[model samples]
Structures are given as structure tokens and as C-alpha cells.
Target: MTELLLVATGLRKSYGQTAALDNADFSIRPGEVVAVMGPSGSGKSTLLHCLAGIVRPDGGQVRYRHRELSEMSDAERSALRRDEFGFVFQFGQLVPELTCVENVALPLRLNGVKRKEAERRATEWLDRLEVTEVSAKRPGEVSGGQGQRVAVARALVTGPRVVFADEPTGALDSLNGERVMELLTAAARDTRAAVVLVTHEARVAAYSDREVVVRDGRARDLEHAA
Candidate 1:
């Protein structure tokens, strides 16, 4: 049986009068790729944020390996995010002043890895992602696709248990988007890491092992839908 890596139960969140997530429950197993899909304002991103500890839910429990996130101190949660959870957002989010390898090495450096060793590992990941030629360039110096590839390398450099990707391909053309998703999913499988992917595109969600649809702040597994 596949082991469950994370679980969120009865999650509820809101921003004033706007409800972002409502009684949403979700789970991820090791090495599984689960896509969260919905229309704009459907709470897909909110759900991802809540599960990742980036945003605390108004009410609910997010558990990583049976440890409740709500019960953890802010510092503990921050540490968990830095050490165990990797994130890829719509934008590449690489530092403009940093080179590709340096951007990839940031997570490792944060976790106390020596700069030389971190860059070595970062180089390996850049090669794996087919972006080694751009390793010396800063984010602005690279194309959107190349920058996103660097972002993926950075997310995987720490060998995180779970990767939270929100619209990871939203800023690219369809071709680049597909390539990015392929690389992202392949890397996650190679590392035995689970992925919580947020996307509204059916093509993007097709790469997932399963899909969940969010509507009116509630989430329902597409496979279980009647």
C-alpha cells in the first residue's frame, strides 16, 4: 500500500466575506501527483496554501506524517516549510541578482549546506532539468521556460517530501508548459516525492495521478464524482 504523506481534514478558510476553502479534505500519498483544478476564485490556490502551511486555515487540521500543523509553533511550521516542503509558483520567483545555480542552491544553503557542495548538487539538478547551459545566467537573462526550469531545480534540490506547485506553467506557452510539466512530474517520480499541483487547465491536470475539483470553496475528487 502506498503510504500517506499528508492529509488535510475539514479545512475552512475565508478572507472577510469571501470564502476561500470550505470543509475541504484532501490527501496525498508518497510519489503521487495530485492536481487541484477549479475556476478562478474557486479556492484551489487557497487549498494548496493551507495544506502547505503558508496560510493557516480558519479551522481545520493539516497533518504531515500525523503531526498536526495547527499544533506546531510558527517557527516550527516555518522550518518544516523550508526543510520538507518545496514550492513552485506561477512566477519562477528566482532572485534577479542570483545565477541559475545560485537560485537552485538557495534552499540547500538555507538548510546549512556548504556553498560549494550546494552548487555542485544544484549543477546536477540543472543538468537533469536540461538547463545547465543557463546555469551562469540570472533570472532576467534567461527565457521564461529556462527560468521555470531553474525554479524546478531549486524545488527539488532539497529532496523535499512534498512539492506544492501552484500554476507552475501558467506563464509559459503551451509547448513550454508541457515540457515543464513533464520535467516536474518526472523529477518528482524519480525522487519519490508527492506533488500537489494547482492548475485550471485540463492538459496540465492530465499529468496527475488523480484530480480534484474545487467549486464554491469545496473540493471533490473527480474520480469519485457521479
Candidate 2:
């Protein structure tokens, strides 16, 4: 049986009278990539935020491995977010002061791994992503695509069961965006991580195992490759 990495149902969020999410239900199975598609103001970002536990829903439950994310204490949720879930935002939020390898290793070090071990593992993954050439370069020294590739490495370095990405390629040109998405799809498959990618482009969604259309604050049943 496929394991469920995330489960959410009846997720609702509103700002005064504006409903950002209305009766949203989501389930992500292990090692699967689920793409969310919606036009602007469709609450795609809100849905990703809620699943990431960065935002609390006005009404709903979020489960990660059967543990109620909504019920966890702030510290617990933070730990869960840090350890079990990884995230890549539209911008490559790498620390400009840190080298690529250092940025990738920062999370592991923060989670209490030894510096030597973290760097070793970070280097290994960077090598896999073909970014080891710039492992010593600061974010400012690298190209935008390379920076995003590093972000992908950082997100997966800890082996999180699921990774949340919002508009991951929105800042890039078509070629670069396609390359970044390729790395994401390949890395997720290689690591067995469930990836939840939020994008407006149908082409980007095509790389996912399934596409879930979110509109008017709700989602349609997932569509798979024909």
C-alpha cells in the first residue's frame, strides 16, 4: 500500500469575508509528485502554506504521517517543518554570505549534525546535482539557475519525506526553468520524496505524476498522465 505523507481535508481559510481556501482536501502519497494548478487568487499559495504549517487554517486538520500538524505545539511543528518537510520558494533564498555548500549544510548543522559530516553529505548531493563546481561560490557569484539548483539541494539534503515548492521556476526563462524543474523531478524520484509543486504553467505540471486543479479555493480530483 502507498503511504500517505500528508493528509488534509475541509481546509478553510478566510480574511474577513474573502475565502482564500474553501473546503480544500489534499492527500499526497509517498514518492509522488503532485502539481497544483490555478490562476491568480485561486489560493494555490495559501494551500501550500497551510500544508507547510506556515499558516494555520481557520478550519481543518493537517496530518503528516498521521500526526495532526494542527495539534502540534509551535516547537514541534517547527521541528517537523525543519526535519520532515523541505521547501523551495520562487526565489532562491540562499544566504548571499554563505557558499553554496555552506547553505546546503546549514540545515543539517542547525539540526545538530557535525560540521564535517554535514559538509560531506552536502558536497555529495551537490555533486549529484552537478553544482559541485560552484560549491565554493557564494550565491552572488552563481547564475540564477545555479542558485535555484542549490536551493533544491538544500531542500533535499536532509532527506525530507516531502518538499513544498511554490512557483519554483517563476523567476527563470523557459530554458532555465525547464532545467530547474528537470532537476526537481529527477531529484524527487531519486530520493523517493513526495514533491508538491505549485505552478500556473501546464507544461510544468506535466512533469508531475498528477495534476490537481485548484480554483475558487478548492481542488479537483487529480489527473494523471494519459
Candidate 3:
């Protein structure tokens, strides 16, 4: 059997009286793309947060590469997120004051990389994501597609082991969304980075190797079920 990069078992989370995740289970292998699909308010985002160690579950456990995520200290988890994981959100949340290249290099800069070296590598990723022309442009100066591509570039610039993308294309048109997915998934696969994609769109989910459906705070791995 292939080794698992991340695994969540019997997970549970709550907000006030509301349960966001109840007994949800999920797993992903290295270099694999897994889409968590469900409607709005279905807890898909919550599950991704839990898996990425952004949120601590009320019960159960999340293991990554044989290490328990819940067992790590806050600083350790912060460091892990900084060095090992990447994220892309629905709005292409690039810093408004920074140019596209600067945005991409932000992660490396945060990791103590020199400015020149960081932007150089960031430029490379921008080129790979087909947004080289916008390297000097600010987020507001670019089109939605371009900005999302830049976001994708930023998520990958650090060569993260795993990427947590939540509705990465929700703000784009179909054509732009498709292009973003193509570039994002292709880049992740090339880097051997596992992707945890959360989306309600089946077309987007089709880009994944497997799908986990989240409904009412529970998860069902379709591939495993069949």
C-alpha cells in the first residue's frame, strides 16, 4: 500500500452548539490530489482547516507522516505551517501594497531568505504559472485570472509538501477557473506536493485523483467506498 502523507480519524469540531465536523475521516498520499466536495456550510472548509492544523479538533487525531499534529506545540505547528504547507483561498488574497512577485516571495522572505534570492525564485514561479508579464503589477492591476494564477504561484514558491486550497476558483469565470486548476494541479504534481482541494464544483473536483464528500459534518471517501 502507498504511504499516507496525512490522515484524520474520527475527527470532531464544534462552534458553540454547532458541530462543524463530526466523526469525519480522511487521508491522502504523497503527490496525490484529493478534493473535498460539498455544498456551502457543509463543513468542507472546516475539515481542511483541521487537516492543515489550523484548527484543533475536539476529538480524534490528525497524523502527518507518522507524527501527530495535535501533539505539536503552537510554535511547532506554526513553524510546520510556515515551512511545510501552502494555502490558496477563494479571493486570491494577495497583499494589496505588494507587487505580484513580492507577493509570491513573501513566504520565502518570512522563512529568512534574502530579498534578491527570494524574488528571483518567485519570478520563476510566476513564469511557470504563466503570469510573468504581471510580475511587477500589483494585485489590483491584474485581471481575476491573472491574480489567481499569482496566488497559485505564491502557494507553490516555497515548495511546500502539502497545499490546502479552499475554493481556489470560486471568484473566477469557468474558463479562468479551469486554467487555474490546470496550472495548480500540474505544478503540485511536478513538485510531488499533495493537494487538499475544497470545492463544490464537480468540474473542479474532477481534477483530483480522489474525492471525499463532506455532508453535515461527516465525510465519505468515494474511492475507498467503491
Q: Please, what are the lDDT tens digits per residue for candidate 3 over residues 1-226? A: 6788998988999999999999899999889999999988889999999999999999989999999999999999999998999999999489999999999999999999999999999999999999999999999999999999999999999999999999999999999999999999999999999999999999999999989999999998755444
All candidates in order of lDDT, best leading: 3, 1, 2
Best by lDDT: 3
Off by over 4 Å in 2: 222-226
lDDT of 1 by residue, 8-55 (tens): 877899999988999898888889999999999999999999999989
Q: Ranking under TM-score, best-scoring first?
A: 3, 1, 2
Off by over 4 Å in 1: 222-226
Taking every candidate in turn, the Cα RMSD to the unseen true structure, in Å, is: 1.6, 2.2, 1.2
If scored against the real structure, what TM-score would every candidate get? Answer: 0.97, 0.95, 0.97
How much lDDT does candidate 3 score? 0.94
How many pairs of residues collide in model 1? 0
- Deviation of model 3 at 105, angstroms: 0.5
